[model samples]
Target: MRRGDEFAAAIRRGNRAGRPTLVAHLQVREDVAEPPLVGFVVSRAVGGAVVRNRVKRRLRHLMRDRLHRLPRGSLLVVRANPPAASARSEHLAAELDVALDRLLRRRGPDHQARTDGRV
Candidate 1:
């Protein structure tokens, strides 16, 4: 999941949800047996190397609690927006929660149906 290809695939094929501070792309992979894979993208638009690393650290910490909530084998890429550079951790966490909620709800019914082995 650390590779650029993985991030590109998620961005291209996954469902997306966004907030002012962050954007998330998620794709469910049926063949994966491992826990959810999460990646962070903090562009230069967000800040310098120090700032980007800080943002990434904050995101990673926030996502730890949320990993279990994601579908198993899901690929998730969270990109920090420019606004995120000045955003507080709480604000980032709130936005992440909202985005994840929306994304999960959008896929919920279909996922449940598939897991139940029904069309």
Candidate 2:
């Protein structure tokens, strides 16, 4: 998820959804045979280093709570919008919930029919 190619692949090939605070890209890989991978993108356009890192931290915390819901071998990239730099954690969490719900619900049975525990 840290690699540029990983990020690019997810962004280019995955399903995408956006909210006021953030945008999410998700790519499900049936061949990975690994757990879900998640990455964050907090650009300078969102804020300076301090703000960006804070936003990343908040996103990490938020995603951690829902990581278990993703299908195994999925790749998810979360990109913070400028609004995320100053938004409250509660607001960020709400936006993230909606984003995850939208993305996960759209993954389809082909992606969700694995033996793994996924929704």
- Best of the candidates, TM-score: 2
Write candidate 2's Cα lDDT for 1-119 as tens digits.
Answer: 78999899999999999998899999888777688889999999998999999999999999888888787888899999999998999999999989887887797766555524353
Pull out the clashing pairs in model 2: none
TM-score of 1: 0.89
> Which 10-residue span in candidate 1 carries the lowest summed lDDT?
110-119
Give the clashing residue pairs of candidate 1, or none: none
lDDT tens per residue, model 1, 47-119: 9999999999999999988877787778899999999999998999999999988888888675754422222
TM-score of 2: 0.91
